[model samples]
Target: MNASVDTAGAMAPQDVVNLARYPIGDPDSPERAALVKSLRDYLDEHQYVALPDFILPNARSRAVTEIDAVSHEANHNSSFRNCYLSRVKNPSLPEDHPINIFEDTSNWILAYDQLPDSSPLKTLYHWDAVREFVAEIVGEDRLYDNEDPYQPVNVLIYNDGDRSSWHFDSVNAFTVTLMLQAPEAGGDFELVPNLREGELDNPDGIRAVLEGKGETPVPVAREPGALCIFRGCTALHRVAPVKGATQRLMAVMVYEDQPGVVGRPDVNETIFGPRVAANG
Candidate 1:
């Protein structure tokens, strides 16, 4: 991504993402086909793909500004959860089991409602070409925007001492995220992919990873303007505690296999806080 490359004139919202390298707008182009195939190969092998320079410098800088402005209104969440993403532990399992292991977690969540319709994030999330490209890479026949008041998109802010505990995403969904800014130190994204295979419960493997013994975790390299697609259903992932005064900003966009999907009430409450958690 050429941080110094300046576009002489005004560009469209989609142009914010470097279409020159991605060429996603032209679905039939040979370059677009090659890009999809390349990303698929990487995702199939590693269960994750990070495309750097996905967004231009102007967009990245503007997104950071937009997110920072509303960040104070974001819900400051701090708590603990096990790898299973549950507040409660399984007493039936042994103490050393992964289910019983808890980790500290903290972050600020900027819900979709906080952003205006003109927000660059909304433009990127609603773009049909970008959505279609994501579906193609994930091998989904078609994907629809998540129809939720606050769950459709979010800006996750991690400041000094904030971190995400290890957890698995919904087994049936793929996660798409865009990096807007990076902190001075720490705040690393790390994950152990394919730790659990098939239907068999890899208790020992899970326990070993939680205990930080075997199975080294892979650290994902992402810079501002990078777009990432990852299948985290079976992976154990966490954000290392951020260090320094600068805050780390990342935007997450949600899409569904089918239309009319909304988050569970309880889930919404926990993530977005109670003020706007009521059913719409």
Candidate 2:
């Protein structure tokens, strides 16, 4: 579909996305086609793709400001989690076992439902062009935002000393994140590609990563306003602790293969809060 204006008269995809830098709205454009092909190929080979300055600088600055202004409202949570990104403990295993090692931490999150309509990040998430472009690059027919309002979008914040522990995604096939701000030190994203594909039990490999004894994991360059597409289900990854007083901010866009499917109630309550309501 051609780009359309939203209620505020901003271009559906253009106002938010830097089309000249990344022509995701117009698939027929040669630049768009080439960009999609290259990104897909890179993701296929490396299990993730990073596009620096995916959002224009001015718009990105606005997003950062908005998120910062609302930082006080963010819900902060932390807990110990295993490599599977779950809090469940296998009591039968020894404490030192990778399956039993739960050292993951959490960061603050502002769910989509909490974002106002004027939020640039929220508007961008609802754009058809953006969704279509991501689907094409990920080799999916199309992508659907989660029916659960809170699950579809989020602003992940990493304050000083905050970090996401090493783990894999539990549900989504892929994750699309845009960095809005970077701390002065740390908050690096590290990934081990294809670490446990097709294997249910890869304790040795998991333990190696947890123990920091495996092959050197790839460290993704930190670029504010960059869009990162990660195949989290296949690649084990984590966000290093934020070191400085500055907070790290990112917008995480969640998509689903099926339509009208919201996140489970329990998951919603766990991530957001009890006041969370279903999108429908």
Clashes of each: 0, 0
Model 2, position 256: C-alpha lDDT score: 85
- What TM value does model 2 have? 0.92
Candidate 2: segments with Cα more than 4 A from true spot: 1-12, 277-280
In order of appearance, the predictions have TM-scores of: 0.93, 0.92
lDDT winner: 1
Please list the C-alpha lDDT of all candidates, in the order they appear: 0.84, 0.82
Clashing pairs in 2: none
lDDT of 2: 0.82
- Those runs of model 1 whose alpha carbons end farther than 4 Å from true positions after fitting are 1-11, 278-280
| Model 2 Cα RMSD, 1 decimal | 2.8
Tens digits of per-residue lDDT for model 2, 36-151: 99999999999999989778877788778778787888887798998887678888987777778888597999987676556678667878888888898899998887766676
In candidate 2, where is summed lDDT lowest over 10 consecutive residues?
1-10
- Across 1-280, the per-residue lDDT of candidate 1 in tens digits comes to 1134232343475658788889998888999999999999899889889999998888788778878788899998998888878879889989888888899999999998787656667777877888999999999999898887788879899999999988887545578889899999999888888877666667788888878886998988999889989887877788999999999998999999998998888878888998764544
